[model samples]
Target: MRDFNRYRHKGAFCLMKYAAEDGSEVEWIWNSRDGVTPFCVSNRTGDKMLQHVDWHLDRRIFDYQPMPCERIFVDLSPDRARQRAERTIEHYWNRDDCAHIRQLFGTKEKAIEGLLAESRVGEAPDLVEFGSLEPGAYRR
Candidate 1:
């Protein structure tokens, strides 16, 4: 169970505060002085402070329960979920032209582009293979 609240300051700014499951106090405060950026803070040291863009991308921030509940579950937006999946999936590129040459990219398109760029002028695309390595999965 967790508690959440929104506090307003003289009709100028708003801040959202919540108690984490781990008993830490978390707050998302906007910098009214700058009139732009918003950042997150937690009483617990070493906690990652999320920036405005990060907060917007996270669906959990907007799904807080006003009343105490057993648990709260929030699903990531389709675009955000896909971005997360891409992060964990490592794109790999290798060409038959060089047995010892292999490279890793963050996206499939980049992997293929890398392989094509490294190929000789007349080299066939069939000599190259682009694939993704699952998280924690390895190959020789």
Candidate 2:
């Protein structure tokens, strides 16, 4: 039995919701970024069973090949994960304008970068929790 873990792919991978042709909303775990188009995208379970065929010299060749399903899973290494963490932090940091937090990083991107460097992927010290801003400031 092969343990084929799709989440543990070679590049950045995330569980994304995709709308299928049948009007059914299915959860598909893909690694492709927003703008880039993939050659082919499959479900998290990269299983391809007899979906194509080919004809050879006096013989028919059936293709049960595993199609390349959006080879976008960023190599899930510690370094790569750390890089992703930095990117995530930078994204949030750029959009965040709480005034109080801005004082901590006055005209200094390095301050934010250093803070992110000290943290791990998906885990960061909440600026709000640090009493940098008031609660109920923004609601979705």
Candidate 3:
């Protein structure tokens, strides 16, 4: 019943872990990349979950192979979940909170300031010729 919760990458990466017990074995589960990943990393946290994830490990012990972690059954409908995820992305994108998104956001004051700066430089030409030595000197 232990828990550690926090935001990472400025609320971009949200991961959750769970502990489960099956018969005589224990397991740990974790989701990476904001819980968007299909599979969860499972190892007894102190046992071999970390090692199982490690590609270089070759140690052997138990006779029968045991599954370290099981994927929790997602109750949310896939289509609805996808739509929600999309909406979340769009929300962040529009708010300018997501830097990964190409578009930028600015406050009203900031937008005005930016416009003023651009105006200081004069209106930008709509089109320019390639390899032209100077701007506006050559037209399409």
Candidate 4:
């Protein structure tokens, strides 16, 4: 089977292309730094999923964007993930309050997860819905 999923916000759209082999999932998000490692280690068996809804504006990058609160998630390759790690390090270097954990992961998913943890200021939004992949790509 063929499937496509998209997460659309005010200014961003994150799309996922998965075959039936990849499973059926609606959202992907990690709620806590402590849970991230376990979730990853466990391959999402009990991990929290991102809820489908309009994400809040990202105040930091919003000025540059027509919509300020959109969060975009793109699938990452090894190289891109490494590049993201480097970029995240640069972005946080001047901020003493930054978390060292962002750069700990070897992959972009991990690093991005770290970024989300560090940048989050409020509770996770309520206008969202999360569902496990029908078949799922991974098993814990």
Worst 10 residues of 4 by lDDT: 32-41
lDDT top scorer: 2
Tens-digit lDDT track for model 4 on 58-107?
12221122122222222223334444556876676545575454445655
Model 4: how far residue 73 lies from native, Å: 7.3
- Candidate 3: the clashing residue pairs are 43-49
1-140 per-residue lDDT for model 3 (tens digits): 31224323221122223323332433322222122322223343445332123312322221222232333212233333444445555565445455644343344344334334433121121111123223322111
Show model 2 residue runs off by greater than 4 Å. Answer: 1-24, 30-97, 121-140
- Which candidate would rank higher by lDDT, 2 or 3? 2
Candidate 1, 16-118: lDDT as tens digits: 3333445434444322110222233333354644323333233223322223221111222333334444443333133455333333464566644554454
Q: State how far residue 112 of model 3 sits from its true place (Å).
A: 29
lDDT of 2 at 38: 33
Ranking by TM-score: 2, 4, 3, 1
**Residue ranges of candidate 1 with Cα displaced over 4 Å:** 1-26, 29-75, 91-140
For 60-122, candidate 2 gives per-residue lDDT tens digits of: 112112123322222133444456556655566555565444567664365556555665433
Off by over 4 Å in 3: 1-17, 20-78, 97-140
- List clash counts for every candidate, in order: 0, 7, 1, 11
Question: Over all chains combined, what TM-score does candidate 3 have?
Answer: 0.20
- Say which candidate scores most in TM-score: 2
If the candidates were sorted by their lDDT against the true structure, best first, what order would they fall in? 2, 4, 1, 3
